[model samples]
Target: MYENMDKEYVLNTYPRNYVNFKQGKNATLFDDKGKDYIDFTSGIGVSSVGHGNARLADALSDQVHNLIHTSNLFLIEPQAKLAKKIAELSGFDVGTFFANSGAEANEGAIKLARMYGEKKFKNKRYKVITLEHSFHGRTITTVKATGQDSFHKSDFSPYPDGFSYNKDINDIYNSIDDETVAVMIELVQGEGGVEPFEKEEVQKLAAFLKSKEILLIVDEVQTGVFRSGEFLATNLYGIEPDIITLAKGLGGGVPIGAVLTIHKDIFEVGDHGSTFGGNFLSTRAGCEVLDILEGYKNSGELDESFIYFESKLQEIAKAYPALFEKVVGLGLMRGLRCFENVDLSTLINRAFDQGVLILKAGRNTLRLLPPLTISKEEIDEGFKRLDNAFKVLS
Candidate 1:
């Protein structure tokens, strides 16, 4: 069976739960044994338009049958179109650098910040300030950029320097020295207990940093691409970041990442590149995703979907305050912060056993990043399963 083969051949990197999905329909996934489960993860918010999407499948299939990869050596059609589409949707009149994952996008953004500092500051000002509990990625330098200590294990000791984690603006300012060049953040800290930064605080911090000429980098890797009811989560704070890193949901299940530089051109030829970054297939998939999202937006379906997602979570939290005392996050990216005595693992497992797939964040936050294309009926079914799980626990 694939399970045994996966256990034997695949690297034991992930927790690798007992569930093995065979296929998916909208927000529902079916196990190999034919049991159905309502998916609330969206593969950690990657499948923005839902799985088995006809438009996405058709686009990918056409791209597969035609052209897949041509590297960056020559011009690619979908890549160019996707870049322009991002510009149209985001209103960022700047260049975009393509990469393959969130880590790669963050890495590129870091390089851009450092490059900017190197060229403009006349002095060495390459240090980037990040917030505590922020999750960037798994790459070595990104691990260093991540604010969590747990990700900085002994195995990857002596992490690459030039990054600092701070909780408040005073702490960030205090930490800034002659080497500080930029401050990176996520408007909605998805992994950090689904915490949404207040717009006023974000505006204040952004203004302060701008006064110092320090660039602002928003890691929209998890919060971008209409996941938070906007083209980009950075728009929610009304701040135009010097650099925005996007991935996860951009490709709608395809592996693709991007670094969008807003009105700032720091990279020249031979500055940065990725081998499999902006391949034809990935860009084509991205185009289809945008098409689907734009369709949803135009038809008023997207707004309706987000309203349902948020209202259901709020209702559920109110219904089961013992298990989930509060709800946090914007749009579909949500979390239920548990009470002190609630065991997160038990609750997650209970939900999984009740034919529902879910995720967690921070210590006790039940994170939910369901597909944006999820229907109201699917939402009802998922909440029904969640109610069953909460009933067993509370």
Candidate 2:
């Protein structure tokens, strides 16, 4: 029916890769035609706990029964509780400003850095250094902050001047003479392809920037909330970033974002605001998701699962060296780097045909963001579909 309806509907937008999806549970999705598929992409890293988690559904439903929303004008209990929990998890004894999406979180982080620069440093530095092959968001300022030149096409010029991109550590050092305020980086550059920066390089840059007293902003939209085997990927680097941006999996399946700062002194009141951010419903969702993840951490079950899952991926990469070049990334956020001249979109379509949903990153990388609750059986099934896809492509 959807295929038929599309015939009459305008195709102004680019064609979608998938034709249909009827329903889903955990790490499986069913199409309108009744084919079942293992879901490896996890809605591009949004469904962290998995599809239709009963706990999340029950929490959301229970909240709807009592209170769905109250304006930010009035103090909300759920929002406060969630904020305290997030602050505790972030290792920051500071306040949080919430938003509805990752872009808003990034925007808020950018604003906070600029304010920190203005108030603390007397506005000596206002430029932000974002790394090349990074993806921020589609908003005007974020698109400009994004380092990919391809994204600059189609009237993205007149961009905010403070944002610039750099390639090497020295290049970044050169970019920050006196005008640079903050250096924002993604531990794992998700949309730019699943490229994890070298640890030594990152540590060197962080040390230099910290000596300069510049704010280090880590974009954890895709790496935070235990998706990378830690609450925040920064914990792995052992570096203390000044500001961090979070979204995607914070609220389980709900829309929520947060801008966290290590020092609360950077902002006075009236520095920023959000209408629907940290309201009753969204904050409740975030609190519940965090609670669930914390339970996993205590049980050590998640750690075991991820260790096994990542090992399996490495084994698969070794088996198919011709097609699967290397498995990049940590924990559940993995990228299967394919050989050159191979089209991952076509390969993903073939996987879908064989009953598995996946996503692509960069040009030749097949990104996999399976739900945290996915079982070993499901992982094996998804890889079977991937193997089939490789066969078809070959």
Candidate 3:
């Protein structure tokens, strides 16, 4: 009934599955019909901690009872606390602006980058360099920034210029001109399939960009919040990015986005703002998420979880070599690259049918991003279901 209602009233934007998930706990989701499905996608990496998280729920509940929202004009405590926490965790003296989604975070990053470039360079250094198969957002400017041709539809004609696509470092270096201000990249291209950049390559790029005064913006929307076994993916590469955009898992499940301006005061007064961003509720949630993740990290639970998840994925990859050609990803954010002959679409459908949720990416890849708080037992069960699903395909 809700699915039909969605089709009739809601905008036909996302190509969605027919499952009506009613509730979830830890790493499992239950559809409206009461069938349980192991959530390997984590709602596309948004549910970092987990679903129905007691800590987050309790914190938000208390927050809602006390205060819900005010505005950017006034001082908000949760927002302040979250900003401080993020700045400290980010490993940089940073200023943070909050928004409501990953797209908004990326948009803010782009704006700050453009402003900084023009101010420092004394020219219109507004052009940005993104990579092929990169997806920034659905907004007009961000979609234009996206490198995929499928997203550049004729419907949204007259695209905003100053964005270019490059495949490799040579192409990026060659493409960088006087007008180019920044090169935005995802350390692990989550949506482009779970592809991670070489650590040395990223360091080289950072060094070159620093030499040329081109800011490096790291989009940690899908890969942040311990998704890649680190606080930020940039930490894995040992690079200090000029700007970092975060959403998805920052608030665990709340709709919140953050743009951290590191190394300097980039955005001045009246530069950029958001209405409902960093509200009382979302900030409380974000604080709880940080506390929870920090607790896990201190107890050595985070490290153990990362290692265990990778081993489980390795087990599956070895079990079904033909179906899962290789396990490719950073930490818990992983993918199973399917062989050419494997029925990718059918396997996805079968996984759903077998009560295991998953996602697809790239040409033929099974993207797996389970909750950071997911238990080893849940991982085993999820894979047990996946193994059965693969057998059906065989």
RMSD of each: 1.1, 1.9, 1.2
The lowest-lDDT stretch of 10 consecutive residues in candidate 2 is 10-19
Q: Write the per-residue lDDT of candidate 2 for residues 1-394, one digit (tens) a residue.
A: 6666776685746556545777878898887878888998888898888888899999999999999888888988988898899878867676788899999999999998888778777556788999888998878888888889888876756778789899745688877867788999999999977888877888888898889899899999999999888888888777778888999989987999998887788777788888888888999999999999889877997898798888878877887777777889887889889888677878788888788888888847989898888888898888887787667555
Provide backbone clash counts, one per model: 0, 0, 0
lDDT of 3 by residue, 1-394 (tens): 7888999999997888888888999999998889999999898899999999998898988998999998988999999999999988878888889999999999999999989977888777999999987888989999998888999999998999899999865579999999999999988887787888889999999999999989999999988877888788877889998999999988888999999877457688898899999999888899999999988878988889888888888988898876877888987889988887877779889999999989998858889988899988898899899989887665
Off by over 4 Å in 2: 2-14
* Local distance difference test, candidate 1: 0.90
Better of 2 and 3 by TM-score: 3
Clash count (model 2, backbone only): 0
Q: Is candidate 2 or candidate 3 better by lDDT?
A: 3
RMSD of 3: 1.2
- Give one digit per residue, the lDDT tens place, for model 1 in 223-272: 99998888898877788788899999999999999999874567888988
Task: Pull out the clashing pairs in model 2.
Answer: none
